[model samples]
Target: MVQKAAAILMIIILTLTAGMAGRQENEKEQPFLVQITEDDPSIAYVLVRMPNPVGLLPLPTEGEYTRTIRQIMPDGSEAVNVLHLTPEGFWMEAANCKGQDCVGEGMVTLENREERVLWNMVVCLPHQLVAELITREEALAMIGQ
Candidate 1:
């Protein structure tokens, strides 16, 4: 009889454990998509979503504007015109990480699948911050917004 009682207790414990594990899994799967929308005409809204707990960060959106942001200079090297794109337009600026590799990045008007894959890819120079736009899905899962 005592053995029977012990067996039942073990089963109950296992069930509870399983239930808790399932809940955890569900929570982990909840946040997986982030959406960046055009908020104020002056400022763009970058909405990020991630699993519960991970929060979102508001990035500053003020930089230089130029048609030839990233370009191939007369020298065989590259040149980046450190420009930050906002709802208003692109800002003409320069990053500290001089050189031309980033400038050779060409122009990124809209984010393509290839660009999205390159999210979080940027070389922060002492004077400039080069960045790429993350996809909605990636942003969601990244920030848990």
Candidate 2:
């Protein structure tokens, strides 16, 4: 009887812990931050904007193409290559900051998560800027309005 009671207590504790963990994870995943759809790939453009403070930002990868857009400093003193992204890896070219995060993030895809999540490639840049992805519905919404 004691053993059975102990097992039940353990199970209850584990269940409660798992529920808390899941809630935390869900909180981390903000729905407004991402907008994914099951539409054409040619019309998709993932937009990411890094927050202030950090000048350099990592880029997002989608499909086989990657684009790097150089950005000017807030003060307009220098044109720095702030966004560096690839299909499998990303790098910040001009920023001298040292961190293993950009290199650690390997190739990420959008279609893989389309069925599960709304946004596939939305990510914050190194400087805390917000990144946005333009989905078909979003684009249509913008054009229609």
Best by TM-score: 2
Candidate 1 Cα RMSD after full superposition onto the native fold (Å): 19.3
What TM-score number comes out for model 1?
Answer: 0.31
Q: For residue 37, what is the lDDT in candidate 1?
A: 50
Q: Which window of ten consecutive residues has the lowest lDDT sum in model 2?
A: 51-60
Residue-level lDDT of model 2, residues 26-74, one tens digit each, is 3321111123434434343344443321111222335332333323345
Clashes of 2: 10
- Residue 13 displacement in candidate 1 (angstroms): 47
Give one digit per residue, the lDDT tens place, for model 1 in 8-126. Answer: 54553354345446443332211211334546122222222111111222333454322222222335343333344443322224532446455444433334424533334433342
lDDT of each: 0.36, 0.36
